[model samples]
Target: MTATTTPNSHTATGERADLLTALAKQRHFLRFTTRDLTDEQAGLRTTASALCLGGLVKHVTSVERIWADFIVDGPSAMPDFTAWTEADLARRADEFRMLPGETLAGVLAEYAEVARRTDDLVTALPDLGATQPLPKAPWFEADAEWSARRVLMHVVAETAQHAGHADIIRESLDGAKSMG
Candidate 1:
């Protein structure tokens, strides 16, 4: 699709259309960071941080999926963070590292699918004004609420932030840059 093409170009327009466009642009950059790298290269921790290209893909996929679910089903739909066991928490913390058998190709495909679903949700939701209480997470303020639009913006921010992280990781891996 052209840069002018909004998210869900078949139907989206106005602010929602613009938001979709921004989100897509972030996703594009994130994918660009992973291009032309082998599985081994993609999994290399080029920096002191544990982050790798494949892990970033997995992370962004998880973030978008969770927020998209919130946009559709509200706070209760989110995973019960308080209920997570130590092992579950450890696994969640390790999402930014490539696990055995997790190929770059597979992770990228999953990320793309999540992006598509998020775009579809943006197009299908009748009300961007729909609000959901924020879950009781340490990062979130107490009793906070977010509209669907806010959730979309959050996804955009999350994707964009991680894309920058991925760009640095990719550059460190082989001196490749996602931008000119």
Candidate 2:
């Protein structure tokens, strides 16, 4: 699928460095995806499911935190949205929507913070060939095993998918051009 690319694309290394390509591509995807949301639009839930830009972002963030913990650190427990209903979803929605006491500025500010954090993790753990046991997870001890490489792919996939969602949601909110 052709995606909306960011204007200031991050640097890519090597001719066939799959990891580099995924990281750069996903980073740009994120930048362009969240380019158009207003404080209100970020929080708006206008459809039947009423998915809002903010809700998606928050979901992505939480998901990233959880996965990063697993990859860079170890599997960390976080909220499971699958077990949630509208009210639970709405509460997450509010995280994106800048309430009277909220600020969209902070959410936007996170663009760089997240980038830096993920970049550090990628740079530090450039090798993905090793497999580690998830000690806390009993099920992982059996048939469930993943390599560092697979974990990296998972992060790229997760970010890239959400970035796509952000692109569409942002476009619906405003006619602003994504830096593609």
Candidate 3:
């Protein structure tokens, strides 16, 4: 939950260690950016975008959970979008906006659990080179395959990118910057 060492610590010897460490470092930065924010503060739309600290936490958790599922079951394991109801669509859209009754603490706790699950999978995966086709998505190349290692790197990138977004939002909130 806490990243005590640098991201390089993850790569001391093996690729798995490197990926996990990078993921952990990104998670740590994300958490650190939200430190001291109240539920209201975290939910505030400090920037023009719908992004908020709590929402960022929720989004990252969802991303990790889905990707972890893919790691275990391959692309066929992804959710069927055609079957999604209006409520489901709305919920997915709202994943980046902390709504009523949501608390930063609760969101952070959930994210932590998701992170734990991902870490466990990273350790348990028999082979990082095991490949799977990318799920249908606009951002993904059609029918492209991704190795397990690539998926881990993708998760790390997603977390780090969102960490930057959170840092910006937090700075706007109270001038509390995660980086100097």
Which candidate gets the maximum lDDT versus the true structure?
1
How high a TM-score does candidate 3 get?
Answer: 0.88
lDDT of 3 by residue, 84-147 (tens): 7899889898998888999999999999888877877777688999999887776688889998
Give me the overall lDDT of model 2.
0.59
| Alpha-carbon deviation at 90 in model 2, angstroms | 8.3
The C-alpha RMSD in Å for every predicted model, in order, reads 2.2, 6.1, 3.9
Estimated TM-score for each candidate: 0.93, 0.66, 0.88
Clashes of 3: 2
lDDT of each: 0.87, 0.59, 0.85
Which regions in candidate 2 have their CA more than 4 angstroms from the true location? Answer: 1-17, 76-100, 133-142, 176-180
Best candidate, TM-score-wise? 1
As a whole number from 0 to 100, the lDDT of residue 17 in candidate 3 is 67
lDDT of 1: 0.87
Model 2 scores worst on lDDT over the 10 consecutive residues at 1-10
lDDT of candidate 2 over 1-180, digit per residue (tens): 223222234343442146656766876776665554567666765544455666666656665666656675543343443366789877766654446644455665565566556555554565666565444433345436566677668777877887776666666667544555
How far does residue 119 in candidate 1 sit from its true spot (Å)? Answer: 0.4
Which structure is stronger by TM-score: 1 or 2? 1
